[model samples]
Target: MPGTPGKGEEMASDLSQSLPKRTFKYQSSLPPLPVPSLENSLSKYLEAVRPFASEDEFKATVQIVRKFQDGVGKVLHYKLLQRAKTKKNWLEEWWFDTAYLEVRIPSQLNVNFGGPGPYLEHCWPPAEGTCLERASLLIWHTLQYWNLLLTERLAPQKAGKTPLDMDQFRMLFCTCKVPGVMKDTIHNYFKTEREGPCPSHLAVMCHGRIFTFDALCDGEILTPPELLRQLRFVKDRCEGEPEGDGVAALTSEERTRWAKAREHLINIDPHNKTILETIQSSLFIISLDETKPYSTPENYTNMTLEALTGNPTLRWGDKSYNLLVFSDGTFGSNCDHAPYDAMVLVSMCWYVDQQLRLTDGKWKSTLMQTVIDCGNVHFVR
Candidate 1:
């Protein structure tokens, strides 16, 4: 009885037996990542240093490594083993915090990925009077793809017929990196199928002004026509009102500097913290850019660089994704790389591209007439 399987384990075994084996089926059965022997590690290190070190230096380094392996290293190795015994993946948390959260560089140029939208040859080409129209369609398709991820309907991604890890895809929506002094943290609002509620609000930026409105109404994502109406309201207000102070510029500063500035701003006024929280919690940022398209794939590189670093005022550098809609209906994305990899964005963009091609970039049937409230986020210095 002491070694017998429990009810949960028996059920899990039965389910595994009944279901057809597929990609990721054996994920839980994989062996834990092995830790290398200290002797082996030191031997490899000595081999690597031989070419770079003088003979005398190599001898001294070898002696140092020998002492380390015989002393502190053994204690540390035992601690690591104890940690491995308690943790499923010992390196995951350390890797994320060290590689992303603890880095002091500005995330825009250092940790963000930017690329142009794939709409040139497809149904939507560079043209006037198509910016909002194309943007609505793109948003609709993007939401549909997001729904797929939410429902776990997306097929497992693969490379050369081998199934790849799908964990990063879950971070594509409602994820942002919150800045801190020593280490930042990722705030993710994503939920698995049948898990819980996910954030459905979208942030829109125009002329340095930020707005937030629900992208879903009555348990349904807004139709493209409804999205168009919301975009028109933000665009028209931006055209009429003077540009507000670009608080988003502070995010592009060096990590420590931004952290200090953020603290000072929050101290000056508590409302600033609330605004920061709002932006961080939103699903994603949609930038209604006033610039025209570069009109060529080769020029996309420049466009992407601009989208990454162009206007600190109009872009949230820490958001997982910033959808930039140019005046000529061309689009691009500036994405922070902390929560996920570039492949997630690529997959979503590809889905939107294929949907656009299938429908010729036109919304079918009667447009929705719902009027949604969109408000500008005001910040006080």
Candidate 2:
């Protein structure tokens, strides 16, 4: 009966049988980009940040923050340009490239983030002349600014779009570290070489991001050396056309390497204990870029969190909860200094909580009461 079939018909049957079945649902199309309201709200938000500092201190702080933004923004902007320039006949590819540097500049600068004291954000006790406090304040301001920029990017002006989540927040956090640390370390190291920033090496680890900038500076100049700058942002080798630009498909050999690296990162560092704990139990790491082959130690934490949040199996204590919320969520607050920097973290949490409330219906007014009340006021330790 098969031999008796027509030649054209049989060929069609065989071809259809050999092809894989298409079982997945087809996605119709991507929706248009959202138009966020934050663009209009940004000015208002920043203006609100102003009254938190005195007129003189606020003006000086604004200038310093601007300079900091300009310096770091230039580096980031130029890096993007250089990357585009290197692609073979890159002009053709420019239209498709959407990379951008989002900058966050705070409206005010205050050392009393923790409570009513001379602390940078909280009650850690200010160092001599309050240099450490000021430097920490700068770092906090810059970080907050970056978050604002990111929040603006993810504004829910468009339909069917959700606000940006923790993963995007993580990307911004990592990227800002280089510039933020560099700015702080340079300002503080020269200003107070005798006391240094911290009393111990642990301080160095806590603020290690600053070291990247220090390593960039040779000695005489504040700017990074040309070689270091080139190394950090430039990519000479072509990674080749990759799939999805999200989570890269890895080979068996590569997987083994990643497994080993993960173990080392989780087991080796005492300073990273909090980060490791999050990874072992309740942190989620979603891939921001899928096409690239590179991965971060952060991914391990993300992978674990994919299953463990609010799960009964994992019993994270007060310390763990605070760490997870502080690190994972964009919301910042004042808290115990033992697990995290209560000074910076507390202020950040308070700021974020206030901001989020503003976005939600809970806060009736545009200006946060805390901003006015807590401005220059310290939290009781």
Candidate 3:
């Protein structure tokens, strides 16, 4: 007879067997993201520019567009067609490179998405002195959601029963934009169910200091108690120590400026590049904010603005997600728009919000927990 299973073992077995194959099951059969025809694109472009262009400017633009459409555009279209023949999703790479990497603007206001926390509605009202506890629980739920994505257990996203494209969901974790002189590139360490070994480390930011530790220990995600211990250790050290230089600010600068600064930084010290690599390779950033509560309707608006742009000191604007934990136990997120759209983060946040609601934002751990020592990452500048 088989031995009786422990609670954890039984839970794991049930989860593995009960999860439906919904998330990426239909990805292969879904149509490729479409490319607009040159004529349609040019016509739409002209229409869009009409309000901004003078009559002479409009005429000149129209002539130029027509000439290009008849000349170089045909060749470009042919090339695109030829390329599409061999590629499963011909537009995906080009869209990513052009729409995100090549844009040389400040990404904080322009490319990052920020939103208010839903916990204010239920399961943990804005309460003082609960930030750390709430953050620990949020992080635990986040890791569980990440595991769902990794294991292909999350329900497939759809549009009225039709499966929508899920390619962007891959960038939700273990992704960051690497700065370049002319264009930045995304470094995505996330893998599909078939692909193996996504990065398991989580990066935490507090008091202008950044630290990273493995979220997984002994092949299981660290319990909320363990996460709380680690988070508290970082928070306590940050409180005691003077602030770090907040080198992450460079990421908020204009792309080219940041790229140049990054180059200089790397040249100044080889370790700088390694630190950048470490951050880029981590799953996501957890920002431990020390802001006081502003939970009123009017205050919520201010809080949203602050969350969107508040402290560059502790944020890595290029990372796909930055979960902000306020001192009042409220939360918010800033997400880079390059790798994925807002909906991917929205879905993840929604999942966590629902989970928190179900459990009253409390962890159900029984282990005897002690503070785990957290180490800070130092850059020689």
Per-candidate TM-score against the hidden true structure: 0.80, 0.18, 0.83
Q: Global lDDT for candidate 2?
A: 0.25
Please give, for residues 293-365, the per-residue lDDT of candidate 2 as tens digits: 1112333333233222321111111111111111121111111111223333433344433433333312122
Candidates sorted by lDDT, descending order? 3, 1, 2
Poorest lDDT segment (10 consecutive residues) of candidate 2:
199-208
The candidate, 2 or 3, that scores higher on TM-score is: 3
Candidate 3: C-alpha lDDT? 0.79
* Model 2 misplacement above 4 A: 1-129, 153-170, 174-262, 265-274, 277-381
The TM-score, computed over Cα atoms with residue i paired to residue i, of candidate 2 is 0.18
* Better model by lDDT: candidate 1 vs candidate 3: 3
> Which residue window of length 10 is worst by lDDT in model 3?
1-10
Model 2 residue 285 lDDT score: 15
Highest-scoring model, lDDT: 3
Full-model lDDT for every candidate = 0.76, 0.25, 0.79
User: Candidate 1 on 172-282: residue-level lDDT in tens?
Assistant: 888888888988889888775567787777888888788887776665667677788878878887899899778888889888888889899889989888877778878
lDDT score, candidate 1: 0.76
C-alpha lDDT (0 to 100) for residue 335 of candidate 3: 83
Model 1 TM-score, all chains together: 0.80
Ranking by TM-score: 3, 1, 2
